[model samples]
Target: MRADRLVSLVLLLRRRGRLSATTLARELEVSTRTVLRDIEALSAAGVPVYAERGRHGGFELLPGFRTELTGLNHDEALALLVAGSRRGAQVFGLGSALASAMLKVVDALPESYRDTAAGAVERLLIDPETDLLSRRLDAEDLPDTIVGEVRRAVFAGHKLRIHYEAVGQAPKWRTVDPIGLVTVREQGYLLAARSGADRTYRLSRILAAEELAEPAQRPDRVDLGRAWQERSVQFRTGGDPVTVVVRVNPNRREELVGTAVALLAEEADADGWLRLTVTFQDSRHAEWALWQLSTNAEALSPQGLRAGLRDRATAIASRYATP
Candidate 1:
């Protein structure tokens, strides 16, 4: 770990030219004293690192001094390249930074492996805007300023005031104690609380945000996964849940079940259909999910949902009937 820190110190200086011990400590998640010690170790290894004194002074690598110290193997290099291709970093406002870092990694790679690895990565594709079904999966656009403030608040443990537009609701301003920021399926969410009650805000839905001077009222360290899971469970069960029994084509079973909040039971029939007891947040949710499967799935029970679908189909048929 010490060795890794030393190499990282050299790279940080090489890239940024100069950075104070305090800044380095913050970036490396260490201490100013630890950073000073690492600098000593790097210089002892003849790395041509020097320190400048004074308030604005910091550590820097000698002009034109570059190190071939990335030490990333072929598989690792490929993995980084693939990750760059996904453009996931763009969501966090790090697209340009990720690109620059990838270029540096490539330049630091061994010459013989570099060309082969670069060529191999060209054959791989990830997160294309349109999938095989021609369905577009583009991510929602978020203002850099809003994401920046929200991110700063979460990391700095500060409260944030946000102007948010919840679904079917008017825009309103609220102050929240941010717990964490999470991105799932390219959608960003800010998990926070208002007045100590758990609340989750979609980052894209936030029109504006400002980090507050007051520190957030939250745990010093949060188990984000557990918190998110607890919130997810609450959300899944908080609403009026509707359960339905459906017979789905075996081939489309996953398509049907994937949209359900939970699967209570399942059984396969000799006729090649699967019977599933599925729960959804409500009647509208249940109807919408099964409607996506068209005729492949039949809602067996809960005549209300069946009637809703029938009415919807009739409305569509009337639009084209003998027209």
Candidate 2:
């Protein structure tokens, strides 16, 4: 606990620049007395930690005292730099600060490790291209303070209160137990358990978030990784499965069935035409499938889907008809 407190204290000082004993105790979840003792230990270790006693006074790192990172080989140093550079703009906030801290760490390393570190850097080149910039998430627009708090709560198994906006409604406040953070196409989403149900919330929809006083309760058994996978939009649920059959010419059978109709089961006839059967949840899905296989395949079963397709075709043809 002391070591943890020391580490946290150091990070807090580095991040906030200063903190009162009360604030440090609250953040570290320890007593003020404990904070004082830890400060003493840090000072003893040549950390140059100092405290001020006044209305506006608190603990601060002495000016010109730097915490250097030592013990890294060249490869490790290079790897760290490369990883930091690859993080892009998000790092500008947290990543840049961390990279700066790492530089201090690298400076403390012995001369013997410099070559190893240099070798590691030479072994790999990191090029975070400008074109890929669009792929990075825009964390700048998000609340800087709460984003990190929400992340901590999620990882620490705590609950959160969020003001969220759905597609067609004004933003409303909701309480959810944090589960996981999902990154999709460079957007950050929070997979949370709603207060009264087993549903997840998206972080992008969250207008604001704060941690709750009560600790989070874990499920009897949790498979967070599996739950994340099952929540993907591609996972199907609750639909009447209808089978559709299609006929394709032999010459284009391989191209059509292999690429376009591979999801369906196919059978080839002696005349070089292929008959294919596929099951879909709804008429719309079937229609979409037909559109993709247009001209290459013809519907052979489920008269309803065929009729709908025909109706759509008529409507499309009528649109271009001469007056």
Candidate 3:
């Protein structure tokens, strides 16, 4: 472990010259005393590392000391730099690792492209937490301790006990065989098996995790992408859904379509509107979506839906009626 830390220390110093011991300690997640000892070790190993004695002074390598192990070309280095700037690395609790790796990637670039690559990342924004309508996207907060345990369990092939709070359900502790962790649209999910049935748990909902020493009952090799696809298909098709036919203004068709679970059919109306048969998660969902669109969208089928809408509109109309 110290060996890896020493190597990271060297890489940090090599990439970012003249780093203060305090800065090194913060970046390395250690103390200044440890940083001083590491510097002494590097110097003893003939690394030509030296310290300066004043306010603006810090540890820096002597001139002309360089490692020839870098091999990334311009475009390759730029791609890595850009990817390293994304939210996935931080969302998965690998922000520090990604930062260190990007430093190496930038340092590996040719001198002519290094600054350009670094500057190019500044112009790109990936996975902002809010949309154009100012709605907060799903960027759930995952505790570092819980995530670390889940990650360990997934990697070590160990059974994990987690305190999970499913939506609308009380928190409960579950013992699961961790298959893998998946991230979609910035949310993290742990794909595991519970009682030999496929289970998916949102990482944010995991209040705590304990990695058991007993090996998990899972195959040695897993295709997480395929597994995720299968789980997604099951989720999309399993719910008790309600189908509704709706006639919507041509301009607001997309708004109505966005809320449906599935689009069954669509046609152009004689009045230049769009008639569509779509499915929603349930009647409540169906009523709410059309209600939101007001006059722009009309639910044409499923008599229950139209009645529900009629009752709601009548109530609203009575409340605001001319008196």
Show model 3 residue runs off by greater than 4 Å.
1-69, 311-323
lDDT of 1 at 52: 92
Model 3 local distance difference test score: 0.88
Alpha carbon deviation, residue 31, candidate 1 (Å): 30
Report the C-alpha lDDT of model 2 over 1-323, residue by residue, as the tens digit: 46656877887887787789999999999899999999999989888788888998899987655674334545556767567555433422255577686677567767787657756666675543334545543433455565677787777788888888988999998888887776544456677677555666655677877888777765645676787777753333235666778787666655544333224576777877888776565667667767776787788788988898899899989999977
Residue 160 alpha-carbon offset, candidate 1, angstroms: 1.4
Winning candidate number (TM-score)? 1
Q: What does the lDDT come to for candidate 2? A: 0.69
Backbone clashes, each candidate: 0, 6, 0
List candidate 2 stretches off by more than 4 Å. Answer: 1-146, 168-170, 219-223, 233-235, 238-243, 246-276, 279-282, 285-323
Q: lDDT (0-100) at residue 297 of candidate 3? A: 86
TM, every model: 0.75, 0.51, 0.71
Compose the digit string of candidate 3's lDDT tens values, residues 240-294.
7899999999999898888787899999999999999999888888999999999
List all candidate RMSDs to the true structure.
8.6, 13.2, 14.8
Off by over 4 Å in 1: 1-69
lDDT of each: 0.89, 0.69, 0.88
